[model samples]
Target: MANNNSTDKQGGIKNNNLNKTEEEDEKKKNKKIFIVIGVAVGVVIIIIILILLLFTFCRRGSAGETEATGVEMTEVMEGSEETETLEDTSGASGETSSETEESTEETTAEETTGEEETTETEETTADEEAIAPTITLATYMGPVYSSADGVCYYRVQANVTGTPAPTIVWSRNDGSGLGPNRAQVNLHSPSETYTLTATATNSAGSDTESITLSWGCNRPPTVHEITLMGDHIAGVDYTVSAYATDPDGDTLTYQWSASGGSIANPNINPK
Candidate 1:
């Protein structure tokens, strides 16, 4: 019995030692769980601080860029307004200069027109200052008679008068005249009449007068003699001679007949 009580006390002591070891293991596990929780909390706090700093920096940079852009826009708008004002001033000055030039040209045109009208009036007045004359008679100077040989001699004259003392021109069908005054003529056949015309003229007009003169004759021309140039050779060369006359200075003709050797240039003066 005493040996059994001693074994029971020894078992009681082993149970107390196992109970102490279990209590120590439970305490160590609780401490490890607390350390893990603490480490997780510290890492979360550091990540929150870095995110807040990044957000603040980005907001400040955006604000600075917005201010610089607004200043550039204001400068560009001011330059544009100044350029528009200069252009408006130049346009107004150019219009004023153009209007002045047009007014000067119009005055010059009016002066030129007045001068041309005055010149036309002067020319019309000058045209009214000239005049002409009239011719009254164109006749012979005297009452003429033919001589015994059927010839007559006379002088022709014209009478013309006007304002400005116009000049006279005389023309005859039978003879030539000198100047515009008179003509002297010797009539070969008194039966042949003459027509005399006189004209008077000046700057404004002209006039003409005419007359006819006639006579009677009863004689003809006669052939008298014709003289040759030199002597005659048989078959080489030769000349002839004769004499002819007319009382009224009329023309005459001569005819010849040949019955012997050949005559060269028979119709000529020397044959």
Candidate 2:
């Protein structure tokens, strides 16, 4: 009986040791599973945060790029507008320069024409002045003279020096004018005074001169009779007598001329 009791006690102690080892193994497995679940939850949360940050950054970068593009387009439009304005200003400047040149040319032409006209007028005046005429001399030739039929004749002369020869004209105080060098008059009275005028004329001017003359008739003495103092023969000496008469009673003196003979005193009283 003592041997059987000691064998039963040893079997009980072995079974209790086996049960404690199994419980320790089960506790270790549960601890390990809790730790793995905690680690997985933390990894999932970190991935979600990274995705949200990436999306926000992309949206900000796109907005910055759009603003830069709009600024570049605005600068290009302003540049084009400035270029067009410059072209318009250049065109206006060209037109103004052309107009100025044309105006200057017209002014020069007018001045040249005016100078030509003035020169022509001056030349014409000079020509007219050069062609003017002048008179030199105007006078009478001599005194009046009487003719056989109680007619009178007078002469006048004139001379001129100029571009053209001058014409001479004679005028009498009897209201008669003629173009002759000599003038004729019939005197009804014994004596008459006459005034004669001569005029010298040309293209430029004229000159005049006058002369005075008188015409008259006077009777002359005539011898009536004569008597010789010597004989009619030659070389004979004798006294002589003479008788004389005159239509005009005036003092008388005698002179003798010999043709072919000689005498001592041909003008002695008759005996």
Candidate 3:
């Protein structure tokens, strides 16, 4: 009986150790399952995050394409409006567009081009209008003529054209005229050179020309008989000398000159 009781105690102790080891093994299996589940959850969350980022990128790309297309459409629309120039349908005239009426670059570029052009034209016209009316001098010739006998006097002749018939200004350095073109002077004085300068003037401008008359000479003087020094004596200066009669032929004298230059013999005929 004593042996049987000892054997029974040993068997009980072995059974307790086996049970403890089984419990420990079960706990390890449960912990491995929990770890695997946690790893899977983490992987799934990472995939979801990646998917969300991809979706956001796609939305941004689509938005960019829409914006770019919109801008291009707007530019095309604006360009068409700027380039389209339809003809006007107004009635009442039989006039057509002129070939020379070319549209300027500004016309196509700006909306207010017509007004700007009109303003410019008006200003230009105003500027040109400020200048006064000009007169063309048609005839500025002649030292024209005047002579004194009983009631006659030294005169000048010229044909001038201006707004108003030019007023005559006469200068007589030769005491041959009484009060100038309208006066008479004694041609019987000591030989003297007479100059007749005339200025033709109008309200706008004035011009001058001169001629000389010699008095107290031996014979009838050809007042302005220009002599030739060369072959073509068109506009050349020359020494002048001529004859003048004292009308009564009572011992006459002579004086000759150019504008102011004197002649050699004032009382005799030239050789």
Candidate of highest TM-score: 1
Candidate 2 per-residue C-alpha lDDT over 91-183 given as tens digits, one digit per residue, 9 for 90 to 100: 799886888799999999999999999999998876665434443333343333344543444444444454445566766532235344444
**Lowest-lDDT window of 10 residues in candidate 3?**
135-144
Which segments of candidate 1 are over 4 A away from where they belong? 1-108, 145-154, 162-165, 173-179, 184-186, 216-271
**What's the C-alpha lDDT at position 75 in model 2?**
93
Error of 3 at 133 (Å): 63
Please give me the total number of clashing residue pairs in predicted model 1: 8
The most accurate candidate by lDDT is 1
lDDT of 1 at 260: 74
Q: Could you tell me the TM-score of candidate 2? A: 0.33
What local lDDT score does residue 19 receive in model 3, on the 0 to 100 scale? 99
Those runs of model 3 whose alpha carbons end farther than 4 Å from true positions after fitting are 85-271
Better of 1 and 3 by TM-score: 1
